[model samples]
Target: MFTSLYTASAGAIAQQQGLDVTANNAANVSTQGFRPDRASFSDLVHTGVRAGEDAPKTGSGEKLAGTETLYVPAGGLRQTGRKLDYALTDGRQFFAVRTADGIRYTRSGSFAASAATNGRFYLTDAQGGLVLDRQGRTIEVTDEHPARAPGAFTFRNLDGLRKTGDNYFAPTALSGAAATAPDAGLRQGYLEDSGVDLADVMADLIQQERAFQLNTRMVQMSDEVAQTVDNLR
Candidate 1:
């Protein structure tokens, strides 16, 4: 009976998390360069159940391991006709940028330029991260050479990159090192839209809600069973 209770509790938690992730995806449907997240689950430890002289079998339980970035292909592109706007038709690459802590990466190509105290024009992202090149140096867009393109990088392990806010990602040891993306095919005067699909997100959300209700029913039934036993005593 206790095992059943634990299983039901775990199921409820897992479904709740799935619903939360779905909600986040819906919220970011219009966010540029956004990737949807999916919940990953694993089975928890089980207990053996014996039936009169029969072989023992285990009951089941579950756990939410973690969330994974779907990292699906790039979405449709919209033409902005702006010099700083760039669109990467390929989803397998990232744009490197310099931050206060270190270099971060993103797929968002929206950029702007600002003049530093030294009177040099530096290209930066919308959030003000200085864009970098394959050599990892701040790209300087001088008046004579103002037409600059961003350097792109590709990861060995996509799962090892952690998403930071503002469409940035930090690579971990597990991700190895980021290398220059091959034939990035970056297009100026365009921007890549977010990869979220509203219809799919809504479908997943509805399924998770139903699963949550079922688990809740199980937990309630388990509690009732326990109360009945106490009453009998």
Candidate 2:
């Protein structure tokens, strides 16, 4: 009886996390270069009789392992006709930028020229992070070279990257070192739309809610069974 309670509680927690991921995806439906997250789950320990006895095996519960970014192309590219707006043809590629917390990577290409200081303008992202070029240097759009493009970078293991908000990603040891992608095609006058699909998000939201409710009911029933045993004693 106690094992059932534990299993139900764990299931409820996992479903709650699933709902959160769905909600976040729905909220970012219009965010440019946004990638939707999917929750991953793993079953806990299991117990069974040895030597294939008549007893059946039972699992303790399941837990949310983590969330994975889809990293797939969104609703295609939209023509913004803006010189600074850019889109990468390869969805796995990213633009390298220098942020306050060192170098970071992002898929967003909506950029602007920072205010001129010392007679020079630098390409910056929405959050004013300096954009880097293929040589890992801040890209300077000089009058002589007005069509400068940002650098494209990729990792060996994309699964090792973690989202750092603002559509940026930070690499983990598993991701290996970032490398240049010289052949990464860039569109100068377009932006990639968010990868979230409202219909799919809503469907997941509903399914998780139902699963959560079912787990909650199981917990309630377990408690009632315990109370009945006490009354009998």
Candidate 3:
């Protein structure tokens, strides 16, 4: 009886976690460059049980051991007709300005000239940070280069790119070293759209909600059983 109660409790907790992740994914369905997160669950340790003279059996009690984050990168491209808006074509991630705090990366091509004293143009992700140029320096475009074509951009590998939030990506050791030159062509007058699928997300949300509700009922039933057993004593 106690084992059943534990199993029910675990099921409820795990279902709740699944619902939370689904909700978050649904909320960010339209966020640009947003990678959807999935929850992976593992079963807890099993306790041994004995039935009559038959061989020992394992108790059915189980709980959610833990969860893993599944980062699924799926986004689309959108055209903005803005000169600074850019997006990678082959899963390539753009490098951005780095600070002492840490290096930031992004896929958002929306950029603007920094109003700082230096008067340098800064490439910013959705959250707005400086974008790095081929020279490993912050791109400072002036009116003269305002309409310059993206002819010089390069990268060692595109898949090794890491997420830095706000539709940005940063190169990781897995991504290899930055290319000595920018080889990727920049597409001005366009923006990248989020890869998330709203229909799929909504479906997932509904499934998770149902699962959570089922688990809640299971836990409640288990509690009633436990109470009845206690009263019998």
Candidate 4:
């Protein structure tokens, strides 16, 4: 009876996490270049089942294994007709930017010209991150100094990159090194939309909520059974 309660509680926790992930995705539906996160689960240990024995298996429960950001492009590109707006033509490439936490990669290209103390203007993103050029240097945007195009970088393992909030991603050892994607052309007057589907996220949220309720009910049932046995004693 205690085992059943533990299993139900574990399942409820997993479903709650799933709900959180789905809600986050829904919240970022309108955010530019926002990638959606997915939750994965793994089953726990099983009892009454040997490695080679054909006995019926009783599983403990499941757990949230991890969450992965889906890199697939969503909502397609939108033509803003603004020169500062840009979008990558392909999926394996990201724009490089210099942030306060060092260099990071992003898919958002909404940029503007920010003036420095030296009266020099440089291309910067919405968060004031300086957009880097192909040479990894800040691109100056002035009449005398023509604005250099932003750099496009590709990782050895795109799936290995870790998201660092604000739609920025950082390199991990598993991601290998960043390489210049010379062929990753940009649409100068376009912006990439967020990688979230509202309808799909809503559906997932509903499913997770239902699963959570069922698990909670199981937990309640287990407690009632224990209480009844105690009363009988």
lDDT of each: 0.83, 0.87, 0.59, 0.87
lDDT of the structure predicted as candidate 4: 0.87
lDDT of 4 by residue, 1-233 (tens): 99999999999999898888889899999998888999888998889855657878898888888898888653489999877788887767898999999999998989888898999999899999999987899988875233778888989998799998898999999998889997446778889998898888988888889999999999999999999999999
TM-score of model 4 (CA atoms): 0.94
Question: Which run of 10 residues does model 4 get worst, by summed lDDT?
Answer: 140-149
Off by over 4 Å in 1: 51-58, 141-146
Candidate closest to the true structure, highest TM-score: 4
**Predicted candidate 3 versus true structure: per-residue lDDT over 1-233, tens digit per residue:** 66666776777777777777677777776665565665666667654475565656554533444443233342567788766766655444454555544665555566665544666665444445556665556665666254243323435765566655555456678777655444453566666566557787788778867866776777788789989989999
Structural similarity to truth (TM-score) of each candidate = 0.90, 0.91, 0.75, 0.94
Q: Considering TM-score, where higher is better, how would the candidates rank from best to worst?
A: 4, 2, 1, 3
Model 2, residue 146: what's the lDDT? 38
lDDT, residue 27, model 4: 90
lDDT score for residue 30 of model 3: 65
- Give the Cα error of residue 99 in candidate 3, in Å: 4.7
Candidate number with the higher lDDT (2 or 3): 2
Candidate 3 lDDT (Cα, 0 to 1): 0.59
- The TM-score that candidate 1 achieves is 0.90
Tell me the lDDT of candidate 1.
0.83
Task: For residue 79, give model 4's deviation from the true position in Å.
Answer: 0.9
* Ranking 1 against 3 by lDDT, winner: 1
